[model samples]
Target: MRRSRFAASVTSLLLATGLALTGAATAQASSTAATGGYVALGDSYSSGVGSGSYISSSGSCDRSTKAFPYLWNAAHSPSSFAFNACSGATTDDVLAGQLGSLNSSTALVSISIGGNDAGFADIMTTCVLSSDSSCVSKINNAKAYVDSTLPGKLDTVYNAISAKAPSARVVVLGYPRFYLLGQSCLGLSDTKRSAINSAADYIDAAIQKRALDHDFVFGDVRSPFSSHEICSGDSWLHSVNWLDIGESYHPTAAGQSGGYLPVFTANAS
Candidate 1:
């Protein structure tokens, strides 16, 4: 009887141990499954236009492994990653082409947009080619558009993103001031540079308002890029890469790694 009782006790202990191990395994599997899915959607900035080393498969989207999205995904190991950002994409482009990648299963979404919608390229060209007064006038025109027409357009895009990825944490990344306030380079005078920076601020403010309205996160990159503006000696943004005109005025690899990535990761919850 004593031997039988001892055997039964040992059997019970073994069974409890087995259950504990199984529970541990189940917990681990659950943790892995809960890591979340990330999707990046936006325009040239998000696609890493100036960072170079584009992913061939991404084509005109010009996605680079060095882009913040890829870097973030590599570090976090999201369950899935979809890079849908394209070069020269406007708000309409995002609605038409990029929104398809987002769905209820998407856990995180990051975007840098609205610059093109404000005709940033045209403004830059005008500034480069025209007088300071003309540039200031053009910048004022863009700001007026941002204050008037842009709010409605941004609302539409933000609303659609919210609808498509209802459960995901959406982060709206803003553009950096391309030039330092008082410094001038690349034929841009201090006045023109200040105007351009002001335009960027206007764009960021509009984006921030939209993000707040939709209860989404706004990743402000101005602080990170403060010391790295184009006129700075240690700038992280490209200053008129004539050989790669498409890459001109965009963030460098250092900008993507040190500027965008940190702001994105910190606000990516």
Candidate 2:
């Protein structure tokens, strides 16, 4: 059975914004970072939407201390930690709204963008509530968008980031793969799960390419969450939370700590 083949003994799911972990070597941030600014940009993943403990002052942006950015800032105590990422942000949003936090004084930068640009929410909605064919079709359209358009948008963002913070070390993080195929998971079909994973791969690959092209580090979270995907025993992502739809498909606090923090830390220096 396909399930048996891919049967990872994982629990809980870390359905998250497009940021994965790759178990890279640890590099401590230089002391210069202590005096320089650290700006966190991108989307909900960067903002800590799914992890809870939302900072009341963040308003609708839903910034959370549990988010990896905040955690990093706390550990490093940079001169300034600008948390500008918002929920439902796109590349244009980052260009127009978030880049202001970045400047020559900025020393470390991290962002998790492009998923929203590729219609992640719509794709998830389709895969979750629609037929299997519909799910596949949505993924195909997203893949096409990633291939034809996302790179350019990413270039624009990366260029802007570079221009704003020429001296900063930027890290572009990826999302985790949501499911482990062949599990008797109750929600989506195996076909849909696999399709979603493929979509993540496409998105991550595209994001990684742009990051490398810009000379920024790409942080892949897949390895960190590999055994803990949806069907695993300990999931860092939240499945569909009917009560709090906003939190659906987002990483749990553990995900921010375990899956995302390490990758960002390794690349930040």
Candidate 3:
């Protein structure tokens, strides 16, 4: 009986030490994965529309391989990535479009939306280039919708993300300047690019406010590209030789790394 009791005590002590060591190792690995890793959300800006990039050939969101998240991941080597950003997605798209890809393991998320919600693309083509006030009215309508409806949609996204990633940090991305404030583009006169940018700013601010409310990180790409506006020399967007053609507005590879990647990293931490 004495021998059996001593053997049992020894076994129990060994088991306890093993469990403690396993737990510590797991914690250390999790901390390492959490440092530079993240999941990406949102629309074209996050997906890299006109940026000529592709993440995978998967028939889902067509996330770009050259998008900011990928760039950030490559630079820092994150443990995992779930990018579900789609071009032309609205705020509702997050729930109906991009939630399944996220999970508890995700360490971060980024998104840019609300442009398609207001038919913003159409407005740019019609109003900014035409003499009608329809574009302005439509823009106003879009802003109102964003201010009112965007929050609820974002709330749903936030809740769903939390359900999946209880420990993940969320980053909401914003649009870049798509048009010149005072400069005219191909066959366009009296452009409302400033107004469009302002509307985008408003949406970005709203997204940021939502982030603060949820204690998530709000990553705005507006100010960073302010000096690199469309039509400006050394523009962050627009390809070489097409000073008038390169989509007039999207982040160059350099811009993505410099302007957006830092925001993602800071918030990811």
Identify the runs in model 1 with alpha carbons over 4 angstroms from their true place: 1-34, 184-186
Clashes of each: 0, 22, 4
Per-model TM-score versus the true fold: 0.86, 0.89, 0.76
* TM-score for candidate 2: 0.89
Ranking by lDDT: 2, 1, 3
Residue lDDT tens for model 3, 48-162? 6445556567443546566777666655566777677776576677778687767766676777666666565555544534454665676788788877887887787788888
Query: lDDT by residue for model 2 over 76-167, one digit each (tens)?
Result: 78999899988778899899889888888999889999988898877877776579999999999999999999999999999999998999
lDDT of 1 by residue, 122-190 (tens): 677667667999989988999889989888888888899889888888889999999976654556788
Against the reference, the lDDT scores of all candidates come to: 0.79, 0.82, 0.61
Instruction: Point out the worst 10-residue segment of candidate 3 by lDDT.
Output: 19-28
RMSD of each: 21.2, 7.6, 20.1
> In model 2, which regions exceed 4 Å deviation?
1-29
